[model samples]
Structures are given as C-alpha cells and as structure tokens.
Target chain A: MSTPTETDAFEVDDSSIERMRFYGRLFLGACIVATLVGIVALIALVFDVVVEAWGWLTWEFLTHPPSYLAEHYDPSNYGDLPTGPGGIYPAIVGSIYLIAMTAVFTLVLGVGAAIYLEEYARDTKLTSFIEANIANLAGVPSIVYGLLGLALFVRAMGAGSSLLAGALTLTLLILPIVIVQTQEALRAVPDSMRQASYGTGATKWQTIRNVVLPEAIPGIMTGIILSLSRAIGETAPIIMVGAATSMFAPPNLTDPTGSFAAMPMQIFEWAKAPEDDFQHIAAAGIIVLLTVLLLMNAVAIYIRNKYDR
Target chain B: MTANGPQTVTTSESDGATSDDAMTDDAPLGSPRVDDAVIESRDLDVYYGDDQALHGINMDIPERKVTALIGPSGCGKSTFLRSINRMNDLIDIARVEGDLYFHGKNVYDEDVDPVALRRKIGMVFQKPNPFPKSIFDNVAYGLRVQGKDDGDVEEKVRTALERAALLDEVEDQLDSSGLDLSGGQQQRLCIARAIAPDPEVILMDEPASALDPVATSKIEDLVEELAEEYTVVIVTHNMQQAARISDKTAVFLTGGHLVEFDDTNKIFENPESDRVEDYITGKFG
Candidate 1:
C-alpha cells in the first residue's frame, strides 16, 4: 500500500477559505450598519430636543404649572406658583401619579395572572385561547385601547374625564404587554428548580412562593418597569381618557374624579400652539420625559444585575 | 426470593391496616419493623400517554439496604425509581397502574397524599439541582416546607451536611450560594437536602452519572454510608457501580421488563437468565 504525503492528507483550498472570510466580513459589516442606524437617529433626536429646550428648560419650568402667557411669565412671583404658567409642574405630578397607580395595578393583576397561567393552569383549549388573545392584544393599536378606555371607564363606568379613568385606561393599554412579558420571565425559570423544590416535598404553593417566584422576580420586575416606561410616554390613550392639556393645580390623588394633566398631553398642547416659543417648551417637555424614561430603564437594569444568579 | 408470587401471597396475608397505622406513627429513621421489606411493587405498570414505559414490575426492596436498578437508556429503571416516590405524577401524560406499596400501604390510594408521602421518601436526580440559595437554606428547605424548622434547623442542617460528607469543605461558607460550589459539591449538597428530612427511603436516579471519576467514587462511598440508616434505592447505568454498592440488584432490559432480581453477588456471578448473563458480560444491553 502506498502512503499518502502529509500535504495530501491535510489540504486546504486557499481561494475558497478567502471567499468564506469575505462573506463573514460582509455579514458583520451589514449588522454593524443596521445597529448604527438606530443609535444615530436616537442621538440626533435627543441633540435637537436639548438644543431647542436649552433656554426654556429651567428649575421654575419643573416647579410651576402651565400658563397661557408662559412666554412672558416672570419668576419673581414664585408664591403664586399654582397660577403661574412658568412650568409643567402639575403635568409632571400627574405623570408620576398615573404611573404609580399603573404600577400597583399591573404588579398585582399582571403578575398574578402570569403566575396562574404559568404555574397552576393546565394547557387546555380555554387557556390557549386566552393566551392567544393576550398576544394579539399586545399588538393591537394604542388608539384602540384609548377608545376602549373612553367607552368603558370614562362613560359607562362613570369615571368621567378624571385621573381614575386615565390611569385605568393606561393600565388597560399596557396590561397585556405586562402579562406577556411576565409570563416570559416565569417560563425562563428552569424546570429543574421546580422539581428540586417538589423533591423536597414542597407543595405547589410553597414551591412557587419559596423557589419559583424568588428566582423569577428579577426578570418580572424588569418586564413590569419597561412596560410602565412605555405607559408613561403614551399620549393617545390619555387623550382618549380625557387628560387635560393644561392645569392650574396638581392631580388630586385623594379623589379619583379630579382632573389631571400629564407631561405628554401638556407637550402635545405646547407643540400645537401658534407661537414658536411654545414649540421650544414642547421640546423641553420631551427632554424631561426622556430623562424619566432613562431613569426607569436604569432601575430595571440595576434590579436585573442585583438579583441575577 | 427466586419466586415472586409466594412472597406477595405471604405479605398480603398479614393485616395491612394495623401495620400501616404502626408505620405512620413510627419515626421513619431507625425503625425496627416486623417485615424486612421497605417497598414492594406488585404488577406495577407505567405509561406516558399511549406508550408504556414499565411493564408488570414486581420486586420487594429490602429495608436499610442499597437496592440498585440496572438498565440501559429507555429501559425504565428511572421510571421505576420515580414511581416509588410518586415523582412521576408531575408529568401530565404519565400514568401509573397496579400497586406500589410503601410500608404495606398502597401509595396510589385516594386517601394517600403524595406531598406527605414524599416527606417520608426523598429523591436525588441525575443532575445536581441545588436551589439558587445559600447552602444552609438549601439544606433547611425540606424541613421549612413541612413547617418542621422551628428552632433546631441549624443543627439539623449541619448534621445533614456532615452525613453527606460535604460539611468539612462547606462549613466555613455555609451562607454562600450552593450554585457557587463544584459539580461534586453541588451533588453532595443535594444529597444533604434530601436526607435533611430524615426520610425512611432515598431514591437516587443516576445520581453520580454527571460527575467525574473522583466525584463518582465519593458519591458511591456516600451512598454506602447512607444505606446504614436510610434505605437507598439507586438506579445506575454503570454495572460495576451496582455490583460494588447494592445488596440486591434488579436487572431491567429493553421494553420495560424486569428480567431478573436477586442478590448482587449471585446476579453478577451466576444469574439464571441467559439475557441477564449476556448483559453482565457486556454482550448486549
């Protein structure tokens, strides 16, 4: 038998190897370009908003309520802050109230629903139908949910154009998203953990409370916070639920029926004003909204880092 | 022991009700019973949906001894082990039939709560699955679940860790996460967790198969030591490991059949069935 040469035993086609390398580089280049497109657009938008907001954005702008004569408003009469049109203070307060209420409702209802579906409910046709509907609801138009809130909460339920109606509306808009994301979080928990808990003779509830939920909490919190950030920036739903564009006082948290003004609605009003100064004020409002969003995302990331094992 | 029918007949003649009551009241560990058998299965069958996994498995697992079930993959050795503790009930499609009796009481009876049954019969799995908690919490979990960890939990946890032969390595860092430990240490931690409840029986399904040779030997030694107090029912794919540790060995072949069960020395040296001898010689699985 003839022995093969070493080169013949281990041969490489240089041209083919070079061609493969070229294709890999081309794919990597395309991916980089795709990523850069999103980053560049976001930077450009933020830069423009900050430049426009530079003169209008002030400490007083954050502390005073909206006014029709905001362009000529003076800061010397700080005692008359409620009547002053120097800032979007009431709108900021309204946004905080709205999100706080939304957070409590979503955490209770969304997390509860997710736990039931993931842990207790069997894979029956009815459950599948509900799961499918939730997925579809997440993709439904925000304006449609606005219409839902208008008809269900604002009119039929007698909540009127109040903070209660607006909060409930925002909750309805983001509830499906929260539920879907929370279920994903729960599903990400390893099945082996459940088995380990059960092997120790833990009942279903004990397993969930002690092992499953604690492990899934980080993911769940991240999902809920992200969904709330989206809800905070929502304009169309609050509009349909009748949030005021401008208000003299902050929202009355004690009374659900009191009128409120959210940042997005306030910005929308300013952006639509005849004077270009109000347009800059709208840009300032956008800056504040973006800051709040960034802060919320930071909290989400911190929670994920702290609890992830 | 060679004939299965006579053993079942004689065991059934005894009054089951009184024995069951006595078994429940007695402490699971170090109990002296009239009968030597801790678990007995009569014509036990298991199925996953339409496909059967175990067929008419009959065996009497002796008390306070290591009983090893040896079989190839898909031969239902693990299935039989899970059936002993009713762990297979977790699978939605899996079903059990006939009788699996623990201390003379049929575990499948309507009145039998699987949660309570599992407290008496703890299990370890093919992989070391320590919870993402501190070592102390992981060991204390079984007791805490049963609301039995009132004050002596720390002492019980320490004793369990010592029994599993992991205390020396992990004692200084008892508050550290169990996941931070090595694979062998994690498996030992899992063994500690299972035995923390002071169960009468410990079911292990390929417990050391995932570990290295050193870890495997450690687990083997630990299993032998555990058998002195707890009845260790182990399922292993390694033939030599079964021969080295088990008091009695049950050979399960393909198609979920229990071909032969006898003393470990007899099964390895002079088995009756031709297939059993062929399997022992590594001719076929």
Candidate 2:
C-alpha cells in the first residue's frame, strides 16, 4: 500500500559521492601545480636579473652621463668614449617625462571610452565593431604602434622625433588595453550598487562619479599601472619614434621639440658595444627599470587592498 | 470580480483587454477616500521585452501608510512595486504603460526627470546593500550628492539612524565601514540611508528576506513606525509580514493579476475573492 520510497524508508546512499572526493582533490592538486609553475619562473627570472646587475649597481653608475660620441656615433669601436661615462641620468629623465606625458592623455581617453562602452553605448553594429576593434588593437604589435606614431604624431601632428612623439605612440599602443581593463573594472561593480545609488535619486553622472567610480577605483588603478609599466620599458616603439641612444645634457623635459633618450634606448645602445663594461652598465640600467616597475605595481597593490577591504 | 476564477492576460488580445474590475471597492475597502492617497496607478501594465509581467494594475496607495503586495514567486508583485517609483526605467528592456500618478504628477511624463522622482521615493532592496564606505559616509552620500553642503550631515545621519532604530547600535562605530557590520545591521543601515534624504515615500522589496527571525521582526516593527511619516509600499512573499506590518494588502496571482486588495483585516478575515482565500489558507500558490 505504501510508495516505493516510503515503504523502503529511503536510505540516502553515500557511495556515488566518493568520486567527488577524488575529483576535488585532483582539481586542487592541478591548480596548485599551475600556480607553482608561474611562481617558480618569476622567482628565477628576478633572481637572475638581480645577480647580474647587483655588482654593477653603484651610486655613480646611476647618476653619470653617457660616454657615446654624439657626432661620430660608432657601434663597433668607441674612439674617446669606449666604456662611456655611463650614468643613465638623461635616460632616466627622458623616461620620466614620457611616462608623465603618456599618462596625462591615455587616462583621459581610456576611461572615457570604457565608460561609454559599458554604460551608455547601445548594442548596435557600430558599438560592437568599435568594441571588437579595441580588442584587436590591444593585440597589435608594439612596433606597428611605433610606425603609427611616426606617421601621425611625428609627421601629421608635427611633434617630430621628441619625447612627445614617443609618448604619443606609446599612448596609442596602450589605449586599447586601458579601455578593456577599465571596462572590466566597471563591469565588476554589481548592478545593485547602481540601483542603490539611483534609488537615492542620484543622476546618471552622479551615480557614476560617486558610486561607480569609487567602487571601480581598485580595478582602474591596476589597469593604469599595467599600461604605464608596458609603456615605460618599450624599446622599439621609442626608437622608432626618434628617441636618441645617447644625449650628454639632460633633454628639455617640457619642450616637445627636443631629442630624447629613454632607459631602453640607452640600454640597447650600450649593450650593443664590444666592451664588457657597457654590458654591465646596461644591466644596471635594467635593474633600475625593474625597480621602477616594482614600485609602480606596489603602489597599485596598496591602493587596491585599501579599497578592496 | 470573479470569486474563484483568476483572470490572466492572453497574447491574442492587445493592451486594454483585461478587466478593470476592483474586488475590494466595497465600502472603505480600497481606502477611506482618494484624498488620503499619495500614489495611484490606473491600468498600469509592465512589459519586459515582449513578455508582459503586470496587467491592468489599478490601486490607490494611501499616504503615510504601509501597503504590502504579496503573491507567489514571479507573480509581478515586485514588478508592480518597482513601477511605482519608476525603478523599472533602469532596465534596458522594461517598459511601463498607463499613468502612475504621484501626488497629481505623472511620473512617466516626458518632462519629469527620473532622478528627481527617485529622490522623493527611496527604496530598500531584499538584500542589504550598503556602499563600501564608513557608516557615516554611507548615510551622508545621498545628502552630499544633493549638495547639502550644510555641515549638518552628522546631525541628519543621527536623526535617520535613530528613526531606523539602529542609532544606539551603530552610533559608537559611525566611522567603521558599513560592510563590517552584521547582515541585520547593514539592512538597518540601508534603511537609515533611505531615510536620510527625507523621502516622502519608501519602497521596500522584501526588506528583511535575508535576515534572521529576530532581525525580521525588528524590520517589521520599523516598517510599522515608518508608515506614520512616509508612504511605504512593500513587496513580500511572506504573508505574515504583510498581515503584521501593512495597513492594506494586495494579492497578486498568476498572469500578473491583482485578484484582491482591501484593508488588511478584511483580506485576511473574509477575502472578497475565493482565490485570495485559497492563497491565504495555503490551498495553492
């Protein structure tokens, strides 16, 4: 008279659950292995770079002028300046100017594009096309961006072969990356937050500025750091944009017309020399570059944790 | 209104196909009079994309009182409530037709700004959602955005928290992150946020659905008190909450139909519609 389940007083079986235990452990082990692989490689690379550059990392090496001849620039044999006065002061100054200039324009353009794509843009063909192009642009080679900088910033805009030209090219190369990341950061904000803001009667702009932007600050900052880091170390793009390999006097940082020498350009030039000392100086320059990059990422991580908590 | 049968919208007919019949129109059932009403909906219909979620909703929400909308899941109870504050406008595909009158102004009027309307009618969601900020800043956010600049933010926040009955608990930790508070405390903090703007109406979407029994009772008690000062329209799946806190109760059924609405006692004691009786008696969802 009773149903099958009721008559049997249905006992729940635990036999089938045993496989989940095995599978879960397997997945966990797989994830750990993947993480260890990345960590080990990163540790090894950092250790190698620090070891090669640590001995050459002196105070004078950091603050001295380049030893290359400006008029008779020879790569194979150095005449008066074989080892070169080898401080990267001018390169450091030039790189800082490029970073600052790139940031000023890229942030304004990138964040705006992201907000439009995420918030305002309708799902039409044009928007989708633009979004697709942005994704593609992020994957475009850095050298092509350098060429773009030459044709547009150097020729069309008359910026010439200066820090402005290099900075502008680098900005073009990283714009797509910034837009994509900023959009992701904006998207990560829960719709509930926007609803809560609107429920309080805030306007669209008001909600974005007050609620959306504050919550997305961590993600936005991470994107900015990542893009700037890429822009700061680039060699081919800067070289194509007419960045000089060596300049004895510090380049006019503010003037867009003056010639420039970035750390990568200087390092590339020195490392090309036959003398071993030039290689040491180049490695030291690399150490400085890595330190600058690490500091930027540290600042980003600190800001993210402060707000994320 | 049919006593047992629940009317549903059919795809064959266009808009204006459903009956405008009112079941609770019997003396003092809907309201004492229209003068006491703050918000009124006439033949309100809501559509999400091509699908209709609410049909022919006509009701007068009394001023300074809590009116609860109760029904089974996806019965358009929340949809109807969101329509009142024009919160549905936030959805890209949601469309609301018919007039939603708020104190004689059509909320959907071309000239009416949705932003301005929202400030007057605040909402607290089913889940407690506070900004990632200090308790004081969370409450002060709406005021600051309104450009109050009056330096009386601390005083206003205290008054609001006191009204929401969370002042004593959170007063000492005003500087602490709202996220750090317990779930119940965060829900209360959201209520305080809604009240800080001095809204004339408050819409609560199952405001205590995520809370424990004690917290649920606390929110129920807060709703009863809030009805004295603001027109509170709430959507809750819990009938007991509707009976306990609401001055009036509207029963939504399948096909986005409002089967019955009346004074809280009549709807519970002797529903005009048989479906309302069945729903109240747990006959069927």
> How would you encode candidate 1's per-residue C-alpha lDDT over B93-154 as one tens digit per residue?
89998788898899999999999999999999999999999999999999999888999999
Worst 10 residues of 2 chain B by lDDT: B23-32
Question: What are the clashing pairs of model 2?
Answer: A64-A87, A67-A84, A67-A85
Candidate 1 segments whose C-alpha is farther than 4 A from its true place: A1-13, A73-85, B1-35
| RMSD after CA superposition, every candidate | 5.5, 5.5
Chain A of model 1, TM-score against the native? Answer: 0.93
Q: Candidate 1 has what TM-score?
A: 0.91
Q: Pick the candidate with the highest lDDT.
A: 1
**DockQ of predicted candidate 2:** 0.65
Residue range B11-85, candidate 2, lDDT tens digits:
223343333243222211233234477887766779999998987676788899899999999899999989888
How well does each candidate superpose onto the true structure, as a TM-score?
Answer: 0.91, 0.88
Question: Candidate 1 at residue B68, lDDT?
Answer: 93
DockQ of 1: 0.73
DockQ for all candidate structures vs. native = 0.73, 0.65
